[model samples]
Target: MTLAWLCLMWVFLSATVATLPLRIQFIPGAILLVAGPVLIIVIGLQVGFVFSVIALAAYVSMFRNPLLFLLARLRGRKIEVPR
Candidate 1:
């Protein structure tokens, strides 16, 4: 679980940084390039499916796309009730 969380954090941070100005983004990417392998080797880090779910939530919140959010909510509701 810890490994998965770390991987998710790294990926989320990397993507967030990439969307920033090049000057700010490059440093993190370089750091990740250098440290990523170490993280995998030392911790067996990997992102989990939960990160994607959270990311989608964030995207919906930021974009306020009612259609997508409604669909997602419906899907989630179906899963929970299964009716």
Candidate 2:
């Protein structure tokens, strides 16, 4: 289905962004980060909860470092971003 293709494209894009330098990746990475949840929601509605959960797990693992950085900032921990 179309949704499956979209998910595949998202995975490919995420992998491509992962290979870029951290600084260079910030923009596209953030975009993907935001889009991920929306994509998962759509998947859940179209397919099923199990597939969406799997996608979410993959998303979390892929963006683990960025997610952690955001968590630290939220907790008021003075974590420095690597240059």
Candidate 3:
């Protein structure tokens, strides 16, 4: 029950972030990016690795752009923000 609620909340928050303008989405998006892995860990412990992996896939798909940007920054590549 709790895991289901958390998943739903994650989906809702992700959807809300998607609706906002890119600049405005940054803070909440970053919060979700940080929280996502912790939730995946808890989900794995509560349920199983398979379910956790599925959740992680969903998370990665939803945040692909931000994740890619972070990766680029980590690699010392320049990221250009479109106007």
Candidate 4:
């Protein structure tokens, strides 16, 4: 129950941060990016794997571009971000 509320709040907060300018979003965006996996794992342990999988899908959907960029970087592809 508490985890569900936290997940909802996280989504809303992420959406709010997303509306900020790129420069302004950097810090908060990074924070949310980092917090995501930890939250997912904690919730999964508390709840169940199915819910965590759903949450992971939502998280990936929301952070698609960034995650792709990260993957590309790991694969040694040169990528650029707009200012």
- On residues 1-83, what C-alpha lDDT tens digit does candidate 2 reach at each position? 99888888989999999899989999999999999999999999998999999989988998899999999999999997889
- Tens-place lDDT digits, model 1, residues 27-73: 67567655555554544224545655664555445334334445789
- What tens-digit string does per-residue lDDT give for candidate 4 at 1-83? 88888888888999999999988987898889999998999889999999889989988999898889989999999998888
Please list the residue runs of candidate 1 whose C-alpha ends up more than 4 Å from where it truly belongs after superposition. 43-83
Q: Ten residues in a row with the worst lDDT in model 2? A: 1-10
Query: For residue 60, what is the lDDT in candidate 1?
Result: 42
TM-score of each: 0.45, 0.93, 0.93, 0.89
RMSD of each candidate relative to the true structure: 13.4, 0.9, 1.0, 1.3
CA lDDT of every candidate: 0.57, 0.92, 0.91, 0.91
- For model 3, where is the 10-residue window of minimal lDDT? 2-11
lDDT of 4 at 9: 86
> Which has the better lDDT: candidate 1, or candidate 3?
3
Tens-place lDDT digits, model 3, residues 1-83: 98889878988998999899988988998999999999999999999999999989988998899899999999999999764
Model 1 lDDT, residue 25, Cα: 54
